[model samples]
Target: GTDFPLDAALMLQEEMKAAFASHEFQEALGALHWATKDLKIAERNKQYRELLLEVQKLIVPRYGFEGTQKGMSLMLMAFQALGYNDDPTVDANTQAMNVLISMDVAGNALAERAAKEQARTSAALKPWEEVPWEVKKVEAP
Candidate 1:
């Protein structure tokens, strides 16, 4: 309604605070998206733009594909948590969430495969195969 950018930034900040306090990762991710949108509105030179980008990147995991998909999935989950289905508008939100969930599942599978490939490549380069080092190893005390 009022200057979408400014409104989005304020709303996003509020959402981010609430999500952090409530331990809602999904909501936090959604709030991060709002912050990104706000950055676009405030322009690249804005003081908060860098902070917003930093926060967005902070939530990402080591695996790029997995991180992206997880962030997207969290946003979808947050939308569902916010009772978006109750909105009077079209069923777009609900439909989109379903699609996001499916995509996330597929993405996770792909990431797993990629991780395996990376490990294989590393293992191939290693000289000592006698004492093998696993990619994702479970540490014991």
Candidate 2:
């Protein structure tokens, strides 16, 4: 997915840091403002982590992640940030459902799925991966 707002936000952060390093007082004031905003988000991120703890308790059983590796990984992450497992044995249907349920988990996986569905319904443009492509061409007779 495209990193629209996050990338933009990060660019703003970099701009702020550069301004601060430049030692220009006027520009540095804006940079300091940016740093204050970032600090506020940092505080919110910590609270979001706590909220995720309660939310995971609800999701774990509903998604049938009760006692499996997937469940274990999720639980472990709920306590602390860590990588997750990719159970190759998981079927496509289950994978699709998980993605559907977790559409907003990242840069919005839901955007891709919605774009494809809208394209199929009419002729709207779709994400590149959803576009048709041919691997080989046959010469005309």
Best-matching candidate per TM-score: 2
Off by over 4 Å in 2: 1-40, 58-105, 124-141
Q: Best candidate per lDDT, number?
A: 1
Each candidate: what lDDT? 0.43, 0.40
lDDT of 1 by residue, 35-134 (tens): 4444554562353334333444444332121234356455445445655435543254334433432323434554566689999987785455555678
Query: How many backbone clashes does every candidate have?
Result: 0, 0
Q: What is the Å distance of residue 6 in model 2 from its true position?
A: 38
Error in Å for residue 108 of model 1:
27
lDDT of 1 at 87: 51
